[model samples]
Target: MKIAFVGKGGSGKTTLAALFARHMVETGRPVLAIDADINQHLAAALGAPAEEATLPPLGEHLPAIKEYLRGDNPRIASAAEMVKTTPPGRGSRLLRVVEENPVYAACVRPVGGVRLAATGAFTEADLGVACYHSKVGAVELLLNHLVDGPGEYVVVDMTAGADSFASGLFTRFDRTVLVCEPTLRSVGVYRQYASYARDYGVALSVVGNKVEDAADVDFLREHVGADLLTWVSRSAYVRRAERGTVGPLAELEPANRAVLARLAEAVDTTAQDWDRFTRYAHEFHRRNAAAWANERAGTDLTRQIDPDFVLGPSALSAPVAG
Candidate 1:
């Protein structure tokens, strides 16, 4: 299962993502956490030291990643021609939830009990030359090609706000945990996200964060309604962890911990929709291709989509055309 935590900036999405990843790992499930947020703080949140937190950003090696994923598929002539929206075909390399491929070997690092991968930080050089979308494109491409299965989990801490809608990245997850605080601005972000998500058939659950009293919960309910899956109360343990004094998962406040379990259960029980997943990959690739990627590549990028292909666990063992 792929779960993404997104919300307004400072709404505690990163903290929730870290906690959920830790919770799943502790419960004996295979979990991988990818920090696709521009801030690149997930490593520290997951208890990695300052030095270890500097992960090999996936953006730095987009060309190499494209090369590996293209994998002798006749439709894609070269990595340079592959855009972030490129969908995997019969001959393309498909990734497992946990694997030893070069992409993971170089980019994935262990932080406590959770496996971590970062989209890299927005650096000084990128200030004027590039958009953060280019960096985040690495994650979009990764999701475009990978195939996950039952008992496996991928937790992504996404960029805040409706910026995710700028690419097809928002549709990549099995479930999205929108960490909303009981504030007008927070609920405003939820409204924007929900409007866009509803069109794509996104399975979203609103997790209210930092609730103080019954009033806060009521506020969330009044705004988000039935989409409100659960809420986390204020916690001294979380505050301590935020301040750098990290503690074990077992040390979390019982109420907050239960919230994490509930969040995990909500994601764990959602059925995988590989058909919808593959359809979006093709849909977005066609859109990107027609809009810009095709002109950039000097060929119709739609050719890259294998009409007979469906990405899933079974696709992993299916025969390749090449």
Candidate 2:
């Protein structure tokens, strides 16, 4: 399953994403945790030593990545020519998660039991002209080519806020867990995310974070309603883990464990419709290209979606314009 955690900044999505990856590892599942956030702190949250957590961001090494994944393919000459919606073709490469692939070796590193990959941070040199979207594009290309089996898991900690809507990344996941706080601002983010995600048939569940009491839980239930999957109470242990004062988050509070277990069950049982997924992905790419990328880059990226690509149900069948 490919799962992503998204929410407003400081909403604890990164922490929760790391914890869920750890939980899966503890349950004997092979997991790959990708720090797709621009802030890129998931490694520390997962209890890796400061040095170990600082793996090369796969985004910064696109040239090498292209060389590795392209293998014998003579068509894809450079990474710069790659587009977000580019699917694997006859000569293109395919990556198998949790397996010994050259692309995986070039991009991922082991942190405890979970393999970790980061999208590298946006630096001062990037300044005004270099958009963070470039890094996200790299991740999109990687995921576009990745193939995972039933027992393998890929968890991504997405960039904060509605910026994810700027690309087709949201449509790439099997499930998206939104970490929402009790505040109205957080709920507002949920509204924005749901408005866009619902169009894509993407499964969404909200994990109410920092809940203080029944009232807080009630508020989320009332506001998010059926989308509210579970709630995690405020924990001093989580605070300590955040501050690096505690060890790895190997253990969860009983209540927290229960909520996470339920989430795991949902993720495990849900069926992924690949035919529908491919169609949604193409539709989103088309919309994003027309709405933004064409103007921004002065080139039409929508054309990258090959005509031969399989078409399933269109995510745009709904009236929502994401």
Candidate 3:
């Protein structure tokens, strides 16, 4: 299962993502937690020391990543020709959810028993010349080629707000857990996200955070209606964790901990639609190719799509050669 946590800035999406990942890991599920957020605090939230958390930034190694994934695919002439939206073709490399591949070796790190990867932080040089989506594109590329199975999870902490709509990455997940506080601004972000996502068949579950009383719960019900899946009350355990005094998942409030399990259940029941996944991959690749990547690569990038290829566990067993 692939899940994304997104919400307004300071709305605890990252914290919730970390907690959910830890919960999955503790339950013996193979999990990969990715920090696609520009702020990049998931490593710390996942209980990694500041120094050790500084894993290789996926964006900084795009060339090498593209090269490795392309494998011996004849369609892709060179790594330079691959865009973030490039779909995998016959002979292209495909990845299991948790694998011992070069990409994982270079970009993944272990934090408190959970595997973690980060989209390199935006630095001073990226100030005026680059979009953060370029950094997140590395993640998009990986998900495009990844084939995950039941009980295996990829939990991503996405960039805050509706900014994810800027790229096809928004549609890359099986579920989007939107963290909403009991506030007007937070609900506004939810509405904006829902409006955009509704058109694209995105399955969204609203998670209410910082709920203090009945009024807060009522407010979420009033705004989000049936989409509100669960809520977390104000948590002292989470507060301590946020303050750098990290504790084991057992120390978390029972209600909040149950909320995490509920999240896992929700994701587990949501079936993967490989046909839709492959279709969207091609759809967005065509859009990007027409919009900019074509001119940038000096080729019609739509040809990168492998028409007979499908994304799922079966793709691993199928012959990748034409």
Q: Estimate each model's TM-score.
A: 0.98, 0.88, 0.98
**Candidate 3 stretches greater than 4 Å from native:** 320-322
Which rank order by lDDT, best down to worst?
A: 3, 1, 2
Q: How well does model 1 score by local distance difference test? A: 0.91
Clashes of each: 0, 0, 0
Q: What lDDT score is found at residue 164 in candidate 1?
A: 90
- True lDDT of residue 267, candidate 3: 95
Q: What tens digits encode model 3's per-residue C-alpha lDDT throughout 246-306?
A: 7999999999999999988899999899999999999999999999999988888888888
Candidate models: Cα lDDT each = 0.91, 0.78, 0.92
Output the TM-score of candidate 1: 0.98
lDDT of 1 by residue, 3-47 (tens): 999999999999999999999999999998999998989999998
On lDDT, the candidate that comes out on top is 3
